[model samples]
Target: MECIKCKKEIPDESVFCMYCGKKQAPAVHGVKKRGNGQGTVYKMPSGTWAAEITLGYYMQDGKRKRKKSRKYGFRTKKEAVEYIATLKQSPKKEKFITMFQLWELFQTKKETLSKSKRTAYNIAWKKIHAEIEYRQIDELTVPELQAITDKYGTSYYTKRDIKNLLSHLYQIAIRDDYTDKNRAQFIQLPELQSQEREVMTKQEIELLWNDYQKEPSAITAQMLTMLYTGIRPGELLTIKVENINLDEQYMIGGIKTTKGKNRKIIIPDKIKPLLSWLMETGKKGLIAYYPSDVEFYDAWKQKRSQLNIRDVITPYCCRHTYITRLTTLKVSPAMLQELAGHEDYDTTLEYTHLSIAERLQEVNRLD
Candidate 1:
């Protein structure tokens, strides 16, 4: 048998066009034809019934393109018929919207989100937007979304954020009749691992110091600042020229929890000169003008490669190094918590990566 719409050949016993998902009518059964645009219903090979209706039409490539709505798995043809009747009573408006288009619409309606949350969602969007931005939401498949989820291999937080943002977008798509389901909701993220946090080695720190003294550019200055101040990469971007008080040897910057936000970060004498140089050469605006943490991370990655550093040190590792150094210096736990902008001392301890030798020395201190 040939499909009635796409004219594709199929099994003779087929009650629906497998190619087009259109309901098929047998000539012998002589299914009664409804009005011009009333749609159709028929029993399927699975003994269930399916119904489909033409919601609207548009011109594409100089041809009239029809938009359709389909419902399947009805127990009986009468059930399918009733479903179509209800759809005719109040037709659902189909939107030929792309993911990016839906994202724009979603943002306009999401006015209550905090600045941090809004930034998070925007960053997540930037990560995977290029993959499916222009594709129509309805055409997206679960495997496609899962592939995107799997691409970011241990970036558990980023994967979660992307999944969260995509889920929200899919919700909006469903509400607007752009798509029937949220494929993102079905995508799974990698299990979170509790790997030991890494810190910059003494050699890497010396290398950075040497490089800064030799040819100090914006990148080296940024790294030195984070290493000394223990400010998060996200917080590092929030620093402004106005926030620095060089004479007072402190700056105000942070983000995330209340304890972390806009906290006073004391600038070490070692890093003060670098900050002064950066502020002098930097524009009269933000200290580091890379818009997002992702871009800053890219700069960090390139700088590491150029410096020929083999260790997988990250900007956050700089913070860990700072905390470890402070702990080694016997800085009081209260002061350490304050400087790290950690809500609790335990959290501050988590960021401190003491080496085995250092731990042994601490143990020997009991003697």
Candidate 2:
């Protein structure tokens, strides 16, 4: 054979001229070449096969760049060919890593996390998982995540949890090259709303005692138990009858955090009769068995309305009243912190909702 352009001698089986690099007029037999950008399958030095495909293109450095993906370690050329064929037929898909996937990764890497903290993360993820669990974390913007957090979050604590979850997921995504930036870092959580803490007034406490004396029902007992013991409304519902120690004057029940979990709550002399009555009535089951927190709260609301108590007095105010009483009695800060199951002394102080008049009375005593 002769080179078509240069008229130089070349091998007869050549597909292109050796000297001029021009295509021969007659095509080669029994050999096929993939078209440009269609992708390629070839044998490797290790005797495995590889397949590659052009995914898309982008402009970089003032030049057009072709983005391609490759897969190696195929044992046979046929497997490589089939794989590349599937890639060519399907629409090009980006490497999408969902927020839920990142969550799984985060959980796997965080082995030393406390059980309570892990539970908190599970709860926080559940709030927004349905909306963005399947969406790629890299595609999510700060505003989008913020909107999701705002929509699903019910309280300052819940919103904080959602923000913390997002921040953690973004951390994993950035570390693994899924994304270069953590958009969660840019998200701003709204400040916690400051409201005047309300506790049951002395008059209100007299009213509850009078009302309970009149009725003497289990519901009345339930309210008085929380009022005297400072048991959280949620914790009150979760208490088992067996956990109540009438002779010992304490019960083992709390939840939500390390400091708050399984802590002993003292059964005050004021509420001991109420607790005993509740134990006998509930009969070894949950002391206050309303299926959910909402139901229990609704019952509390009904009880309040029936008793004609102040509208501002929520169930939480019962716990507040207990703490305020302890503070007024000059309980040491250390004892208050332990009794209230507060991790911080400051948190125990926050629970004491002393009236301005009471504060002024103490201030005047100093003079």
Candidate 3:
């Protein structure tokens, strides 16, 4: 069979057009939809990659020129490839909108949120706006935007937040004739997250500990702190030297939520060597002292690959490992909540992904 939009040959069993991404006409049944036109992924004049698809031709000065519709602002070749593939599968809207215009409409249409939520939404969009300002709604894909944090090397939690924001925007986009479906739903987070690496093996723990010893760098310090304390790396970066209470044997900083703020956690003896090394360095700012977010992530990914553990775990997974260890020690839920700086008890439950042995042991105590 041939795909109607691209005139490309397709297998008899194919459900969607490979070159165009539009749904195929069913042999007997199962045709969901078809793409409006075939799109080509190419380099834009801005030196960025884009998918150039016709938005329908327009006549000007008695001459008809193809009205080009494009999606822009991808940061890498791999992203551009995957993105244009998705655009081919979905049909573009007849009435088009630029991402900048859509963002404005979103701001006006959004209902009120809590102060913290409002602040969070504002902060997230600042990054989103920078990337999407020049692009069009036609080009954005859920997987591409979900990886936005990873592309820029921001935290996984921030990636989750970005995914949420994109999902919300796609909803509005679908409603306003910006696109056909919410691509955000199809996006899987980074490997460690999507795989749900909730706990680290003792071998993995030992590797992380030894790896930090070898480098004794700021990024390693943050990693060790998170492994021992269950603090998010983003929160760990905000901690100043003054927050280190050596006399009290704890640190005081965590700013994600109301309860998380000023959350003092006792420094584990295991992580103190890292803290001591950081203190000796005479650095006056963030402990994880990369010049920018990109460098921080770059350093981490490089080190992870060097450690030969990059495939299975990530720095954020250390926070989950900490929670799992505490749960093994039979830490009470309320105290765990306070120690973990979680605002809601329910949020704490997500971290309590316990093991079979742990569950069996706890259950046997009753008998």
The best candidate by lDDT is 1
Residue pairs that clash (backbone atoms under 3 angstroms), model 3 = 20-88, 21-88, 21-89
Off by over 4 Å in 2: 1-94, 99-134, 150-155, 168-181, 206-220, 233-240, 253-264, 280-285, 288-312, 327-350, 356-367
lDDT: the better of candidates 1 and 3: 1
Q: Cα deviation in Å at residue 334, candidate 1?
A: 1.2
Clashes of 1: 0
Q: After superposition, how far is residue 352 of candidate 1 from its true place, in Å?
A: 1.4
Q: lDDT of all the models against the reference?
A: 0.81, 0.78, 0.69
Candidate 2 vs. true structure, TM-score: 0.56
What TM-score do all the candidates reach, one by one? 0.68, 0.56, 0.50
Taking the tens digit of each residue's C-alpha lDDT, what string does model 1 give over 1-367? 8888899999897888778899888555334467777888866667778887766544456554566787889987788888887766554645566777778888875677754567778878877887777667777788888888677533888889889889999999889777787888898888888877788888888888888899887888999999989988777776899999999999998887899888899998988889998898876477787755567778878889988775578887889889999999999999999999999999998988888999998899895
Q: Clashing pairs in model 1?
A: none
Give Cα distance to truth, residue 172, candidate 1, Å.
2.0
lDDT of 1: 0.81
